[model samples]
Target: MVQKIVHDWATGKIYPHFQFVFSFKFRDLNTLNCSINLSNLIVVFYPYLRNALDYIWKNPERLLFIFDGLDEFKSKIDFADNCTEQQHKCPDPDVRCKVSDIVYSLIQHKLLPGCSVLNLQPSQFLSGFLMELLEREDSVRSVVYTFPHLTIQEFVAALAQFLTVAPRNIVKLLSEAHSATDGRFEVFLRFVAGLSSPRSARVLEEFLGPFPNETTCRVIDWVKEEIKRQAGNTWSEFGKRSLLNTLHYLFESQNPALAQQTLGSVETLSFRGLGLTPIDCAVLSHVIRWRFGLLHGTVISRIGECQIPRARRSNPASGLVEPLRLLMLPTSFSRDYEFPM
Candidate 1:
C-alpha cells in the first residue's frame, strides 16, 4: 500500500481512491494517540476512507465487512445493552470515537444498515457474534472434530522411542485404549524426559543451546520439564536406540567432529548459516563410544566361548580379513580403502 502511494506520486499518476483499503491491527491501532477518528485518520492520510464510507452507504444490502480473528484485536468491544442500542443508531463514520465503537456500530447494523457482517471470535459456540449477524434466523450450521483419538496417537508416535512399551504392547495399547486416552498422553512429556535420564535435561539444554524462535524455545522448555520429571521414574532401555539414531544423524553432518560436542564451545554454533545450536555433540560421541565398547566386549566374549577353527577362519572365499581392515580403518587408511556396499 505504501509502495503504491509512493509510485503514483513519482510517476505522475492519480491516486486510486476506489482501491483504498486499510487494516487496523492490534499493534497498528495502538500507535494512534486516540481512537481512530477523523483527526487520527487524516493524520496517516489513509487514502480517503470517506469514499469507502460513501460506497458502503450506497450499497447497504449484502454483508460488506469480513472481520477475521476478532480475538486478536486487543481493543475492548462494547456489547452493553445501552451501548448496543446507541450504536444501533448507526453513528456517523467521521464521529470521534474509539475504533471499538466503530466495530460495534458496524456489528449492530447501525453504522451500515442492511450490510452483512461476519466476525470470527475464538472458542465460543453458536449464538455468539453469529446470533447478532443471523438475527434470530431459524437455521444455522456447525461441525465438530469427531476424531478425538488422533491426539493420543500423535503424542504416542512422537514419543514412542522414549516409552518402555514394546512393539506388541504399543499395538495392544493403541487398539484397546486409543479412545480412552483422549489427550491424556500430552501430559506425559516429562515421562520421555525420565527415559532420557542418562542424558539429563540440563545436559539436553546444554546441547540445544540458544533458540531464536518461540517454537524451538517452547519445545526446549517442555523437554526441560520432562527431564526434571524423568528423574523420579524407573530406568528403561527404550531410549538407547533413539539416542544412537540422533548420534548417527550428527555423524553424517558436514563437520562431524564439531557437530558432536557434549560441552559445546562458549560461542554459539550454527549450521549452514541457519539458526540451530545443537544440544551436545561431545556427549553424543561419548555415548556412541560407550555403545561400541559394550558391543565389542559382547562380541569378543562370545567368540572366546566358541573358538573358531583356524581352517574355517582362513577360508579364502570369505574375504574376512578385508572386512576387518575396513571396520578398524584409521584416518590415514581412509583414503586407501573405499569398500563396496
Candidate 2:
C-alpha cells in the first residue's frame, strides 16, 4: 500500500502528502502527516505528529507503523523536479532515472544494498485530487471526528495565513457588502487556488498588478473629467437623467444586463471576426456598460450577430463561465465579415 501510494505521487498522479491515523493495542493510537525519507536509517525512525484522532481509530494492526515514523521525516528531501531543503537533496545528475526506478526500488527487493533514488516533483498546491479528497463527505467527517472542528474565525485565520495577507484587511473585507463579502472572497480564493480553469488565475494576475499610485490616480481624475465633459455635451436633459439612473442601477442593483448596458454606452468600439459564446457576451457586457462606454449598442449588436453561431442563445447566463473579467473572442476569423445590427 505504501509503495503504491509513493509510486502514484512520483508519477504526478496523486498528491505526495498523506495523513495516517492508526488504531492499535497497548501503544497510544496516533496520527502522522508528512513526506517520506527512507535514506536515513537512524534508530529505526520516530513518529512526527498527528492531524486528526480518527486516523488512528480506523487502522488497528498498522498502529505500530504509526509510531515508527521513518516515512514522516521532516528533513529537506528534494524530489526530482524541485529540491526540498535540509535532508532530502535533489537527485544527482547520474541519478537521472525513470519514475519506475523509485517504484521498483521501494517495492521490488524489500531490502536494498545502497540508496535508491528517484525524482519527485512537488504537487500543485490546489490539485484536483486535493479538492475532491478534501471536500469529500468521508474526509470532512474524518477531520472532525476528533474535535468540534474549526470555527469560521479559525477558518478565516487559516485563510489569511495561506494568502500571506493581514487578517485585519481580510476581516474588514468580509465584514462588508462590497466586493469582499464572504462568498466573493471564497470565490476569489478558489480562483487563486487554481483548481479548475487556469483562466481565473490569469484574471487574478491582471487585477493584482501594481496598484494605482499618484500618477495613476491623476490619470483616473483626468479620465473622469473628460467623461463628464463628454456627457454634458452629448446628452440631452432627459438623456442625462436617464444616464444617471443607469449609473445608479449599476451601483445599486445586481442586474448584470443593466450593468452591461450602462457600461456599453460609455464607448464606441467593436472587435471583428470574433465568435462570442454566451460567456463572452456576459464579459463584454460587463466591460462596456459600467466600466467603459456610451451607446455603441448598434456596433455591439452587429458584431454579436456576425460572430456568434446561429444556434447559440444570446443570453450570457446560459454559459457556466462567470463574468469575473472580460474575455476576448478569437480574432482569427475572416475580416471581410462586417458587424451586423
State the C-alpha lDDT per candidate: 0.36, 0.30
Off by over 4 Å in 2: 1-266, 292-341
Whole-structure CA lDDT of model 2: 0.30
Quantify how close model 1 is to the true structure by its C-alpha RMSD in Å: 17.2
lDDT of 1 by residue, 70-139 (tens): 6677767776656554444337655777666767876666664554454543322221222222222222
**What shift in Å separates residue 13 of candidate 2 from its native position after superposition?**
20
C-alpha RMSD between model 2 and the true structure: 18.3
Off by over 4 Å in 1: 1-21, 25-44, 48-52, 58-96, 103-180, 183-341
Clashes of 2: 27
| Cα deviation of 322, candidate 2, in Å | 30
